[model samples]
Target: MSEIAVVAISIAKPGCEEQLRVALEGIVAPSRAERGALQYDLHRDLREPRRFVFYERWESEDALAAHGQSAHIGAYRKQIADWIEHSEIRVLKKIM
Candidate 1:
């Protein structure tokens, strides 16, 4: 199997956790339907409601790149920016 992934770490503005959750839920379906999306999951910190993460897997680098420009993903980023404090995004390739 191809092994490519993306990890997104986001900190929501104070009191914006629920809003962020709603926004993230809205994008799930579209992300799953994308051409090479193998998996996409959203996670929240158990101890910190304001912290969130997205774990995504794709078939290849090209597929992941395509996701970066996808309409749903773009919309999510734009809409959530106002509710977010900061974000760190990284892409990875499996070695083991």
Candidate 2:
């Protein structure tokens, strides 16, 4: 089966870039340890300090789904909900 990919875009609340960075860093270890995870990277926009993105690759759809329910992700969601101004999470399947 083809792997699944996810791109998550987030905007931090005003003056909360550092907090967002701390929160994102906390999830890195757990995400990397997930059984189906191939890659999980976080990037901050050079042009916009408040903008952040997460690029994730998983072995399968089921694996991505499992990641959604992961305790680390759940904690991140709760922790960042109030600290974020906006968020967009996209799941993709590689075609080429």
Best by TM-score: 2
Candidate 1 yields a Cα-based lDDT of 0.90
TM-score of 1: 0.92
| lDDT digits (tens) for residues 1-96 of candidate 1 | 476999988898998989998998898889999999999998989998899899999999889888889999898988998899989989998888
Q: Deviation in angstroms for 85 in model 1?
A: 0.4
Error of 1 at 57 (Å): 0.8
Q: Rate the local accuracy (lDDT) of all candidates.
A: 0.90, 0.93
TM-score for each model: 0.92, 0.95
RMSD in angstroms, all models?
Answer: 1.5, 0.8
Global local distance difference test of model 2:
0.93
Clashes by residue pair, model 1? none
* lDDT (10s digit) by residue, model 2, range 37-91: 9999999999999999999999998888888899999999998888999999999
Candidate 2's C-alpha runs over 4 A off are none
Per-candidate count of clashing residue pairs (backbone under 3 Å) = 0, 0
